[model samples]
Target: MENWFSLLQKNVLNQQSWTTREQLRLAIVYWIEARYHRRRRQRRLGKLTPIEFETIMKDPACLAA
Candidate 1:
């Protein structure tokens, strides 16, 4: 959680100034969806990024989840 907050501070909060709560909310949502989750390895998926995990799941030879 510390790491996440640190990154958020550096990448989002520090990079720009927000004039409204709505803008801040949108920025956070966009960051989490576009950058964070796309690249972060998830433990439930055996540490694969969601993109990689989805690709493997689509393969016919891949084991059932």
Candidate 2:
């Protein structure tokens, strides 16, 4: 799948005219919440927030394995 920025540029922007910085920021927020934030798993919430969930399963001795 494409990264966050690419997805937003393709989907939300869709050549729409964003006349102000605020519009760009709003689009980014929508992308993050829809694509990233909601998809993540959080450990505190039992494997819910990818960051927290990933942290729960990671091994400190190895960065990536």
Best by TM-score: 1
Task: Please estimate how well model 2 matches the true structure, expressed as its whole-model Cα lDDT.
Answer: 0.72
Pairs with backbone N, CA or C atoms under 3 Å apart (clashes), candidate 2: 40-49, 40-50, 41-48, 41-49, 41-50, 42-48, 42-49
What lDDT does the true structure give each of the candidates? 0.92, 0.72
lDDT of 2 by residue, 1-65 (tens): 46756766786788688899999888878778877676766566776677555565676636665
> Tens digits of per-residue lDDT for model 1 on 1-65?
99999999987899889999999999999999999999999999999999999898788655554
Supply the TM-score for candidate 2. Answer: 0.43
Best by lDDT: 1
- Residue 13, candidate 1: how far off, in angstroms? 0.5
Q: Residue 31 CA error for candidate 1 (Å)?
A: 0.3
How many angstroms is residue 65 displaced in model 2 relative to the true structure, after the best TM-score fit? 39
